[model samples]
Target: MPQLYLGPWFAILMFPWLDFLIHIPTKVLNHVTPNELTLVGTEKHKTESWNWPW
Candidate 1:
C-alpha cells in the first residue's frame, strides 16, 4: 500500500508552529540574553582571601 498521506499543505500548515517552536526560544533569548554574557566566556571569578595581616 502506497501511503501518500502527508503533503505540501500539511507542511505549510505545520511550518509556522514548527518555526515558532524553534525560533521563539531563540528570539526570546535574543531579547533576554545579555550580549556580553551570551557571546563571551566567563573566567573563574576568584576573590583573594586575605588572612590576618602579620
Candidate 2:
C-alpha cells in the first residue's frame, strides 16, 4: 500500500504545474490559449495596473 502526504502549502508550489497540466491537454485538444482556457465562461476584466509595475 502507498500513502501520500500533502501539506497545506503544497498547493502554493503545485498550482503552476497543475495549471500547466490542465492547460496542455486543453490546448492540444481545443487549440486555446492558457489564458482562454482558464477564463472560459467568465467575463473579461480590464488588465490590472499592478500586473505591470514597470
Best-performing candidate as measured by TM-score: 1
TM for every model, in the order presented, reads 0.42, 0.30
Q: For candidate 1, write residues 1-54 as lDDT tens digits.
A: 334666866887799999899989898888886566554567878899979988
Per residue, candidate 2 scores C-alpha lDDT tens digits across 10-53 of 77679888988997777786654435435456777878666666
Per-residue lDDT value at 36 in model 1: 61
Candidate 1 residue runs with Cα over 4 Å from true position: 1-6, 35-54
Q: What C-alpha lDDT, on a 0 to 100 scale, does residue 2 get in candidate 1? A: 32
lDDT of each: 0.79, 0.67
Q: Which candidate has the top score in lDDT?
A: 1
TM value for model 2: 0.30
| Model 1: how far residue 21 lies from native, Å | 0.3
- Candidate 1 achieves a global lDDT of 0.79
Candidate 2 global CA lDDT score: 0.67
